[model samples]
Target: MLEKVTGLSDLKEILHDKEDEEIVFTNGCFDILHVGHVRYLQEAKAKGDLLVVGINSDESVRQLKGKKRPIVPEMERAEMLAALEMIDYVIIFTELTAKNIISELKPDIYVKGGDYKVNELPEAEVVAEYEGRIELVKEVRGASTTNIVAEISKRY
Candidate 1:
């Protein structure tokens, strides 16, 4: 599973060889894995031949989600995502947005949760620049890491 976790450069080279395959890209902090994340990834995989997940590094997550967030560290989060059968590759990035990765990979499809609108995504431009398709998967109602963490804190 750890083998599925790769750096951007290595993954780029590997993906270059897979030009024949339709590649799907999605990114998130994935601070705490949940059913919503699984379903989203599964749906993203269905969009193309390969699914590449870009995980926000600890610093990035901290910047986006606050310092107390990401109860699970970056490497552990990457490993957990890499272990998923539907995910073909996992890359940890230090960016607050997926724009850079999306620009570099130029995957055939870029996916996000339904909660996001295409016009609002910073990476949408990058995807569009390369003529990549953007997809939004419907989110599992009431299923989110923020809610889960809130519930845990309330119970504890």
Candidate 2:
């Protein structure tokens, strides 16, 4: 049922039809797709009728995160996140942040992992413009892509 990774424009159109439903937006690199990512997505979904995950494009990942980052490619990362039942749609954005997408969709709720301060987020202002509230889900400490990479390096 429309389960696949899509572009921002297409997602905006699709979301237009479901304007009445509460849309929750969250953005991340999700390079390794760890437990923390899964839990965060699940919690985000719980906050609204639909969960839209904005994944940083490969180029954007390299820009936001550094080289040697995003061990998994953007398409693969988006595909993995879209596979999760908790995520209603996966939008691969080219920007370092999902501010443009947020401005266009103006989701009812914006969720982030506990690591971030709501007011500190650059998108906070965009969300605020639409009166959207930001929610932080409890993070699974020590369960990060960096930690996974470190462990892999230690093993091999």
Candidate 3:
């Protein structure tokens, strides 16, 4: 079962073995599940023993993706992510970024897809302070939600 943990208060107990496990953390909109998201998450799981995905809350998605985005609701998105075998836990964030959560979670490693340089990431500093590392996963071309949404709109 994929456990839903919204804040750090519940994570410590849930991830009781985090100190021993490689606890990999990553955050994103994940408004719609897709092949790329699956592949990226699968790869991320391989890098650690436990994979925790932080999904953007509906409000955060609206802020990052604009008002007409997040076709899927927060609960639906969380359920879909939880359905994935690679994902151990799903946390929802309502902020523009997961800096505060990262500080609280203090994951061993943080993963982000695409060509985001370590310095360019907002949470990089905090992760660095905790001696945590951030890795960038290769992005699959023609597999982005934005592109898919655009194509669907064009077809209809």
Candidate 1 stretches with Cα past 4 Å from truth are none
User: How well does candidate 2 score on lDDT at residue 44?
Assistant: 93
- Best-to-worst TM-score order: 1, 2, 3
After superposition, the stretches of candidate 2 with alpha carbons farther than 4 Å from their true spots are none
The weakest ten consecutive residues by lDDT in model 1 span 61-70
**For residue 143, what is the lDDT in candidate 3?**
85
In model 2, what lDDT does residue 43 have? 94
Q: Write the per-residue lDDT of candidate 3 for residues 3-66, one digit (tens) a residue.
A: 5544566876777756778999999999878999999999899889999999898998998999
Across 1-156, the per-residue lDDT of candidate 1 in tens digits comes to 999999989999999999999999999999999999999999999999999999999999999989898899999999999999999999999989999999999999999999999999999899989899999999898889999999999999
Best model number under lDDT: 1
User: Model 2, range 60-111, lDDT digits (tens) per residue?
Assistant: 9898879998799988888888888888898888988889989998999999
Q: How much lDDT does candidate 3 score?
A: 0.87
Task: List per-candidate RMSD values in Å.
Answer: 0.6, 1.3, 1.4
Cα displacement (angstroms), candidate 2, residue 139, comes to: 1.0
